[model samples]
Target chain A: MSSEISSRGPADHDVRDQIVIAATEHFSLYGYSKTTVSDLAKAIGFSKAYIYKFFESKQAIGEMICANCLQDIETEIRTAVNEVDGPSEKLRRLFKASVTASLRLFSDDRKLYEIAASAATEQWQAARDYEVRIKALLQDILLEGRQSGDFERKTPIDETATAIYLVLRPYLNPLLLQHNFDHADEAPTHLSSLVLRSLSP
Target chain B: MSSEISSRGPADHDVRDQIVIAATEHFSLYGYSKTTVSDLAKAIGFSKAYIYKFFESKQAIGEMICANCLQDIETEIRTAVNEVDGPSEKLRRLFKASVTASLRLFSDDRKLYEIAASAATEQWQAARDYEVRIKALLQDILLEGRQSGDFERKTPIDETATAIYLVLRPYLNPLLLQHNFDHADEAPTHLSSLVLRSLSP
Candidate 1:
């Protein structure tokens, strides 16, 4: 059978997705150490043994849930940046997309984010890798702005990008988890304005 | 006997200090949920019931730990601001002190900070009070800068102060606990520079 036909015909993918979703909710609710694989299995109406067929371990399932959420955010950011007209517009769109994505994912699964944050010690490598990916994307935008002569050239693009990341870091996770998006709105505007002005000739 | 003499001697003072120090370490290592009155007492070589003499509960001890840390930080920021002559200098010093204080306290007792953050959920009113105290201090600095004509009126002083808080927030307790402070040297310097410039006429 063709690869598409074989993969699409099996209910394995659907079950796996359901398992991941349930795991994300449980992990977000109770945190990592507090969440048990058995609880997840039951939540998704699967036996403990059945869960093993889809995931190698609870950590592996947790990783998948986080990866899925991050990948969604990355896609939204990439799309926002590409569709925008100029560096300033791109930056604004990207910031808005990030805020929206964070709120959506975090609000949907606040417990998972809390658990992931709490288990940072165990997931440091994964967290670092995710950050590096975000930094790289921001760097690309800064470089594009530089090439277009729309942004100033005093600071290294990478450093500037990291600065943007630092400014946005606190708000991204909290905007979604809390209902205080209004309280957080000014930071991004101020941060974007500051970054843009610093890059201005 | 004099009131001071009845209150405590040098030996009792030493014991109280030791208990607080021990409690800090235990909270930092084990976090609030895992930490117990018995554990704290054992750590400090006191009876479990005796801990109540100094603190009403583990929750009280956690609050004391946070309050003590924030008080030290508040004093440091005030002193640094007073010694500096201008907004630019004062801003940099303030940022440096904030970052250093965060790294020092969290790096020294990661578990304690983690416990303290978790305790915020358990005691929401206390956490909100702590947040208000810090925000008010920041607001005072911004207002002072405005009055001295060191900062411009691009934004309301209170809003600017809130923006600064959001920018510097990730360096505060919970975020500090989540990330390694080993890269303190590499965080964006332009962040402070940009904020100061934004506030300047």
Candidate 2:
């Protein structure tokens, strides 16, 4: 653990990437609280000082792991949403894919889900940032729907977007989703239909 | 404080009511965690032993305060819902009154709102019971709407009611509502319309 891996400068950009990957693995496998800076260094044959050269502290590493999870979700949302044409179908696919992506991300790695849950309770920067992204995504869909006359809104775009986000809570929010796991298959389909029906002119 | 308010036996029913009233004042004024059993005992002119005779702990007293708040909200909702005729109007008033009643409760007593927030985070028994009571209330309204041909449902009564609960969350959930206090008057109006429109035949 005392041995440093890099012949390159400690501030090297590659080292930062390595630190995030190793930290993500540790967070997703053993759990967030249990993983130490020392363990992160050992995972990549670096010393604690070298790890600090990249991430300021364990908390920063935790932030990076949460950011990584949201990024993964965002990428899937974009792909699913872009795959379709028109606002109505795009809204349906995008909303459904967000739930599906999160389920897959958490179900495959329980520890990552635990990290997400912890982030939510602690009100971590990453968690709040994730919400902004989702709301923006919904806002775009609603705006497009309104412009194209495919849907009508009962409120302004921001409020309508927020209402849609809240309505899909049981299927989208990981904490609430945990309680409704029995309806894992049916929830997205049912809730999305309710949302679409609400928007239909 | 050592002087007993009554050797009439700690089981006197009025003693229990007196304790709850004093505790609510202290909790609303000083704060839940700050208000101790000793403080409560002092407030009610009773000994600590007398306080313990009624509530097992400070936590129990906190639970009672939260339960009292929910009961107040329920009374308002029942009165408003029952006063109106037609399921649409009943549902509209029921949802609106729930938000309005909660806003009034939390506004007049910020510390009590804090207690409710704490109870929610701690998932206290009293909090869970309050949710069950609300869901039942919503279920009754939804069923009535369905039977009266004022509403059509895409799901069972329970799920529809739960979805309604989730949808009204921004306006109804104490924690979220605290941030949106400026919309205090408008939230119920907008959200109620959303709820009614969703339920429309």
Candidate 3:
């Protein structure tokens, strides 16, 4: 989606898209905290006023970039889970894929990861929304497992889903993930298996 | 226990104790980030060189303070676990006590908690040592449970302890705890129960 342009005119959309692209490049190269709106305008050959027309603030642009990055991770997790059969296998794949995708971001695109970390520390809407979606996915998996007699139904689905989310929260939240990244490679297998064991009837 | 004084003379111990007390008072009053070595020196009626003689730097002082804070939480956790008879109950109490002690620090001593948060974020020796202690405690609980025919013996004790510690990491690490404090109350109960369920023989 284009940025803050109120109108749907093609030219307006083009300008918004160009600004986002330029900002992403600038942010990646110099890092998010060091780059300012003025630096972005200079790098993108746009006036400060023009950039502001599309973005309300530097954090606004960061929010958009962070949202896109989170979406990429979500997509990878979904694809991995989809290839597996049974709710148990799907949940296992989901945990592994989630950790792998996030770790890749941390190693491959560290600058972007910084933005996500900041977003999480600030409790930005994007970070909160990402958590909500992950919990919803967990609930869906738990419901599926219950229906198939793969998981126990004694624990309320909502509490079960929330608990599972909390277990995964450290690895999912970039701020916490960076600290625990060393153990992350083996964590998914161990954690998912343990959780699956708990879910058994 | 005193600062870097090589000799264990009573006067050296007194000066070190004075510096620590003054620094803690300053930190609690103005927050760790806002106060400086010079501020502590001034507050304690000591020369800046004298303060540095005791602590290599501001962070060195912070490390001691942070270590003390973590030890307080550890003591609380141990007392809570010891009050229980069974491994399951002990583990559950350990989880709850850890969260409660940390949350208390966050609420009652926000400034001190900031120092602990900084220590965790920086991965100071104090923070790492605290984690190692907690994991060791977890291993002990798991081993006890296994011995009593409570926890399953199928999973390796080391691996299971590590997994449980990871689950509890967010609630224990002050940097991450601040973000998840909203869920801290219910988390220990739900999480410990889930973990206990998995451990059942």
Winner of 2 and 3 under lDDT: 3
Candidate 3 lDDT, A1-201, residue by residue in tens = 555345557886788778888888889999999999999999999999988988899999999889889999999988998898999999999889989998988999888888998998898889889989888888888999999999999888888887888888878889778877767988998889889878978
**Sorted on lDDT, highest at the top, how do the candidates line up?**
3, 2, 1
Please give me the DockQ of candidate 2 compared with the native complex: 0.12
Off by over 4 Å in 1: A1-66, A109-130, A144-150, A171-201, B1-58, B110-115, B118-130, B140-150, B175-177, B180-182, B188-190
Q: Taking the candidates in order, what DockQ does each have? A: 0.26, 0.12, 0.51
What lDDT, from 0 to 1, does candidate 2 have?
A: 0.76
Provide the lDDT at A8 for model 2.
57
Give model 2's docking category.
incorrect
**Chain B TM, every candidate:** 0.72, 0.86, 0.94
Candidate 3 on B1-201: residue-level lDDT in tens? 555445557776687778877888899999999998988888888999988877899999999888888898899999999998999999999889999998998999999998998987788999999999988888989989999999999987777887788788888988778778768879999999889878878
Stretches of candidate 3 above 4 Å error?
Answer: A1-11, A33-42, A46-59, B1-15, B30-42, B46-60
Query: Which ranges in model 2 have alpha carbons more than 4 Å from their true place?
Result: A1-11, A25-63, A75-129, A132-160, A169-190, B1-11, B26-60, B76-97, B103-111, B114-129, B136-150, B153-159, B169-191
Q: What is the lDDT of residue B99 in candidate 1?
A: 69
TM-score winner between candidates 2 and 3:
3
Question: For all the models shown, what interface RMSD does each have?
Answer: 4.0, 4.4, 1.3
Clashing pairs in 1: A28-A111, A28-A112, A103-A176, A152-A199, B27-B112, B28-B111, B28-B112
Candidate 1 lDDT by residue in tens digits, A1-201: 698678865688888888887877777667766778888877778899999988888877877776666777778888878997888888876676777777776667667666445334465445556667877877777888888998767766666776777766655544223533555556567656655655664
